[model samples]
Structures are given as C-alpha cells and as structure tokens.
Target: MHESLPISVFIIARDEADRIARAIDSVSDFADEVIVVDSGSRDDTIAVAESRGATVFRNDWAGYGPQKRFAEDACRNDWLFNLDADEAATPELVAEIRKLFAAGPPGTASFWQVRIKDVFAHESGPAPWAYGYNQIRLYDRRVGRFSESPVHDTVRPPAGARLGQLSAPMAHRSIRSIAFHVEKMNRYSTMQADDMASRGRRLARHRLLTEFPLAFLKAYLVRRYALYGWWGLVISTNFAYTRFLRLAKTYERELAARARSDSGAA
Candidate 1:
C-alpha cells in the first residue's frame, strides 16, 4: 500500500551553501521529506542541508534535468515539489499545498504550476518583489518528469494530464551578484551549445546573425524588464548575450568538424 504521504520536496544543489538552508526551511513544516541531491559541492552545502533535516545524497553532475530526475527517483512519495536552491515556498503556497493534500490530490490533474516572484535583500532587509515567471513545480511524478535536456529543462506533463495554477508565488533570490549571473550565463550557454552539437544540429546562420536583437526585445520590452530600471537592462542584456554565445559556440563546433572532415579527405 502506498503511504499516505502528502508531498516530498526535491532540490538539486551544487556549491549552494549560502542559500540551501533557506530553501529547505521554507518547506520544512509542510513537506514529508526534503531531499537534496548535491553534485560534488566543494562548499558546505551537504552539511548545511543535513543539519536542517534534509536527506542529502551525492550524485555526479551530468545535466540539470538528469540531476533533478535523480532526486525524483529518490523520493518516497508520489506527490513531489521541485525547488531550486535559491527559491522558497511562501507561507500562502505552503498553506495551499496542505489544503490540497487534506482534501486529497485531484485525480484529474497531474501537476500544479506556480508563479515565481523574484526578491532581493539589500543592506537594510528584503527588497521589493520583482517580476518572475511560472513553472510546474508541484506534480505527481508517476505522470510527469522533467525533460532530459542538458540546459533549460522543464517539467513535461502529459498532453491529457490536467494542469492547474496557484495564485501565491514562490520567492526566488536570483542573481546574487553580477559576477554570479555572468558565470551562470556562460555555463548554461556552453551547455546549450554542447547539447545541440551532440544531437548533430547544424548551426543556423540566420539565427547566428539575427537572434540577439530579437532576444533582447523579448526580454526587455515584451517581458517588461524595463520596469525594473537598470537591473532590468542588465538582466535583459545578459539574456541577449547568452543567446549569441550559444549560437557562436555552436558555429565554432561546426567549423571544427568541417575542418577535420576536409583534412581527412585530403
């Protein structure tokens, strides 16, 4: 018989000693178990998580989707909530989740999507909430799993699976510093390039030449990043640069491959 467990929260971590504790604590009262899968953190991430009553495990970093799926496999309950180390479940969200389980999860829906709100802490205290997007975090693992893409993976619930949305937003403490944000962009862009190359994808010449401006417009104007002032500009600019980097790296890979093939023919 399946245990009547309510929800199990899973988080994938890597050198997140500075932020993991808060993430774990946010869901501690409501979650049956909090699982943290670390990818060889050189910091005290594992220790901090364990101290907070999280079941910690070590897994070699393969890709974002793979690491998250690994945590899914470790979970004991069917109902799961996937959270990032920099994200926290708000009190309202936690209450809603508890209310969900009290009445029993709906058989109609496979997952619940939640809106995310970006927040920052200044010298004084927590800053005003900033804009954020939505993601499918609460789900039944039997019907949904994260897509296995190396970069920018998301939950892939079935076409017929009923999906619902929640009003309260999850708080995200994103981009702690400009340096941190830069490092993430560089890393994710390289991952995108490698994933594309391994799949035998040829670099799109048109995209290489024109994609950055389109990306910038989408992020800054359409996405309302302009509302945040200079930070919005910086974030939107980073988005554009990442798009360019991914295409540029993919182009380089194609060039190297063609050179190898030509040399062999000669």
Candidate 2:
C-alpha cells in the first residue's frame, strides 16, 4: 500500500448510509485517517462508516457549522479536509492533492479552495462546463476553521492567510430526485428562516413579489444552469424556489412575531 498523507478527512453525516461509503472510499487511499461524525442516524450510517474503516463518532444533530466544527476538533492532524457524506473527491482532485503533499508540507498556503461541481441524479458525472462553487475544503486547522453560524458552514481563514485554489473539482451527489430536492430545500429553507429571525433580519414586502423570478434568472443565467438544457431548467426552478421559500418563511416569522407583540400588549 502507498503511504498515506498526513491529512485527516472529516465528514459530518446523518442517515447517509447509502452515500457515505463513496465519500469515505474516495479519500481512504490517501488520507491518514477518515473521521465520520454521525448525528443520530437511524440508518446503518455508523455501521457502514465503520465497515469502510472510518472512525465513527455519534454527535447529536447540531446545525451545519457547529457539526462541522465538531468534526474539525475531532481530527487528529493539523491538515484537514472536509467532505460531505454526499460528496466524493474525483481522481484528478485526489491526484492533485497527493501531488501537493509529495514534497513535504505545502508552502505558504494555509488553505485551499476546491471547486465542488454538482452531479445530477441521472448523470454519471459532472458535465464539461458544469456549474460549481469554490469552498475552502482543505486547510490547516491552526490557520482556518469552520464557521460557527448554524446556516453557513464555510471555512474562515485568518486575515492575510495565503489561499490557493485546486484546479480539479469534487463531485457533489446531493440531488436524489425532484421530490428529494424539494424536500431538502424545504428543510433548508426552514433553517435559513430561523437563522435570519434569530439575527433580526426582516424581508421587505417587495421581496416576496420579486424573489422567485430574480432568483430564477440568477441561477439559470448567471450560474450557468442553462447549460444543462431541460434538466437545467428544473434545477434552476428548484434553486429559485428554495431562495424564495427562505424569504417567505422569514417573512412569516416576522408576521408571527408582530402578532405575538400585539397580543401581549392587549
């Protein structure tokens, strides 16, 4: 067997039995250790992770950032890579990472942003010009760590920390189906709404009217979802709906709060 890199790959999961193995397998060959922090999964998530040679720990369901923070602390190595249970590192990405570590520690770069491309349910992989976003997935814990916000699970590198970008992209197999996407969006929107409410954010009435169409245009055109043809339309529509739903739900919370204030005054 080849020597593993001194990197700890951590994943925060819940009921991801069917897909967690792929995430683990993708990094198992190169990473020194794989840490799976499961959040009360009823499925065989823990069993599957353990069978695949992952060190599994059960944490209760916290929000995204906190969950990732928990995983970050649990990692043994200073160099860490965070992969979701539904995502996998492509061979090119793996090779690139391996190359980075070949000649001792990476110079100057404390964190590396990786492009995470979406792989639709029917597709085997991402298209040549797939729409994707970059995130700091690989980093040294001393220089960077996952944010604590419940809704935002991004890595926050210290000021002036040198950041590098990986050319190869990771595959995100997040969408199971249209129904599944909708359900996922619904849950996400609720969390987003709650987060906004906690932060005292209020949406204007005009946002309810313009949110869907504006979001649709942004996703379909600016984000290049149009490249996927009809599938792109479906994806864009879902994306738009998710955005609008969050705003609507947040507005609903505002209205409810106002009603509560009025009742208490009476």
Candidate 2 error regions (>4 Å): none
Candidate 1 TM-score, C-alpha based: 0.90
Residue 241, candidate 2: alpha-carbon lDDT: 95
Candidate 2 residue-wise lDDT, 1-266, digit = tens: 56899999999998899999999999987999999999899999999999999999888877898899999889999999999999999999999999999997798698999999989878889988788899999999997799999899999988888999999999999988888889999999999998888888778899999999999999999989998899889989999999999998998888898999999999
lDDT of each: 0.85, 0.92
Q: lDDT tens string, model 1, 175-217?
A: 7887887898888889889888788888769998798999998
Query: Which 10-residue window of candidate 2 scores lowest in summed lDDT?
Result: 195-204
**Candidate that scores best on TM-score:** 2
- What is the Cα root-mean-square deviation between model 1 and the actual structure? 3.3
> Cα miss at 185, model 2 (Å)?
0.8
In model 1, what is the error at residue 160, expressed in angstroms?
A: 1.0
